[model samples]
Target: MSMTITEKILAAHVDADEVRPGEIIDCRVDFVFANDITAPLAIQEFQKMDIPQVFDPDRVAFVFDHYVPSKDIASAQQCKITRDFVRAHDLPHFYDIGRSGIAHVLLAEEGFVGPGDVFVGADSHTCNQGALGAFATGVGSSDLAAAMALGRLWLRVPETVKYVLRGKLQPWVTGKDLILAIIGRIGVDGARYGAMEFAGEALAHLSMDERFSITNMAVEAGAKNGIMEPDDVTLAWFRPRARRSSAMYRSDPDANYADVRDIDASALETVVSVPSSPGNVVPVREVAGVKVDQCFIGTCTNGRIEDLRMAATVLAGRKVHAETRLLVIPATPRIYRQALEEGLIQIFLDAGGAISTSTCGPCIGGHMGVLAEGEVCVSTSSRNFIGRMGHRQSQVYLSNAGVAAASAVLGRLAHPDEVVRAPVPV
Candidate 1:
């Protein structure tokens, strides 16, 4: 039987010669992750157990991302518990508020994950690491506790759904649009519990950041995870880390693909995930003229330096609409420091955008940019479920940071081309 990249990784984890899609195989997890929101409970559960030592302290990652700086008293206590656990176990990797970004981005930036590995995290977006070709997935708190106790977790090998993308995207189109359009075709649960493998010519044109934008939202499609082959761009990112961490690997050429879905990237225009759900998608032009109260750029979805640069291209020398409150958050403290050095922060501030600390912020609605009742906001965050950004009546439009920046300036749904286009190489 031919095995896809995901199946190959799962097989490697289980020490199997070959594993087929849809076949249930209990495999060991290579690493485990828990963020501030879930780490407290997981640690409490771990305390109930009498494990001598964690399977591998180095294999465990604890990040203070969701409630970084602790929004409230309860959140502060939760993070304190996580800090205590990390110190007690002597885990090698601990990302505090100033150092941590979104768990997914920070994971890759720090070289904690690699291809052909089976990794699990206690948060839903844990699948984001799959962009690097690792078979990463999300699990519950109990599972995290068990992984900490034994340094191993189990998984059912998932069936894979391949997306064969073709053609270069037109101006204003981005990986966010590609994934949102796919969600439209497959509906919210179309790929539920299945791995999404992106391939073909269109994928080659996508940058690592863009591929991340696709993989980060795979959970919304009900996927086990989403992955792309490691190309030169990925290698460039990995090679440096390999000098310190273990080496990384690409998917073997003979890797098998289970099902292939083709997409025309050029045909993809700007897409918007309307309020209350990621599946509520439509072309941006269709929703033009609708006014919004706020616009936010930055999240695990599209908060990298490149994403900020794209927004800066739109916001430079332009004022945000008076009625719209625009907020820009860098994904991590490192990214924030880079933006400062690159003058990106000045551009955003000059455009009347509020800069947020490197935390999840309004992406999960803890604070920073919560919307009021009946307010409409354009954002670069992952989900838009009910009350995701604030009051239940508040509406959210999900797009790339480029679109969010453009909409902030225009006070309505606007395309990236209307504000900023991909920079032409000099």
Candidate 2:
């Protein structure tokens, strides 16, 4: 049987001679990542180890991003510990809050990940980088401790689930809609411990931002990873900014797929994942009449420059609906500065969208834009788990930036194509 890119990569990483779908292989991780929120605890555990230094300093990346600028005392303490520990260890890839966006974004953008690599992170969304053909997944504090102590970890090779998307995505329908629709069909945990492989002509047309949106939510499907074969689009995205060497991955044509899903892109519409679960999805029109109190258009999941550009296109010359409170948050200082230089920030401001600092913010209920009881918000951020953003009573609808911006203007569910023709340049 032929293997998918994900399976091929895992095969090379497996300790055994080869790994097949449904088979478990004991393999060691190639890299481990820790950030401000989780690194503190992992570091505390590492101190208990007898080893004087990390097994491979170059293989570890320490990043401070979740609560960059320290929203509260607890977060401030976490950031301090992260900074001190990384500096003391003389790690090669330590990123401060400003330089740090989300760890996965930074890791992929920095060319730290490659095909057949086994990567782990303390954050659940660490699965985001699996798009690059690595066996990337999240782990708990105890698992992170072991990885740090030995620079190694065990893994069970996962089966690959193939999603072959054909046709073109409608103007308003983006990667967020595709992922949500898939989750709705398969249920939240349908892909548990499995690998998702996206292919077909539709993927060839997608940009890096779009790929990230899909891969970021793989964890919601309970998948070990989500991956796509690297093509010209992937190469173009990394070629210019690649600091060091870059690597790519391609799937074997004859590879076996544990499961296969076929999506006709032309058939897709702007879909939304309702509150409390990512798989609670429905078409926008099904819930269009409902009014919303807030709209958010940023997060690691969809807060890149491309997302802001899409929002700006939808909001140009339009005002946010008086009943809705719209907020835009850049994911990093680089993105914030780029938005300013491109005047995308002005468009948002003119549209009555409040701008917040680059942080996880309302996405994780960390800070900013907390929803009140019974309030409803449409957001571009990932996840809609119960109490994810604030009070359990609050409702959150997840969509792409286009839908988020359009909803802000209508104060109800709105599709981006109905409001704008195309994405604005940044």
Compared with the true structure, all predictions reach lDDT values of 0.84, 0.81
TM-score of 2: 0.93
Cα lDDT for residue 328, candidate 2: 96
Reference-based TM-score, model 1:
0.95
Mind giving the per-residue lDDT tens digits that candidate 1 earns over 219-324?
9999988887777777777767642333244455666655678888888888999877899899998888789899999888899999998899888888898899
After the best TM-score superposition of candidate 2, give how far the Cα of residue 194 lies from its true spot, in angstroms.
Answer: 0.4
- Give the best candidate by lDDT: 1
Residue 229 error for model 1, in Å?
1.6
Kindly list the per-residue Cα lDDT of model 2 for residues 1-426, writing each as its tens digit: 456776666666654445776676655677888888899998888888766778888888887777776888988988888788778888888888667776777787777775557788998888777666566888877678788778777667788888999998987788878888888889989899988888888877788888888888898899888887777777777666554453455777777778788989779988999878999999987888679899998886889889999899889988898999999988767778999999999999988899977777788877788888898989998888777888889889999898899899888988876667544334
lDDT of 2: 0.81
The TM-scores of all predictions, comma-separated, are 0.95, 0.93
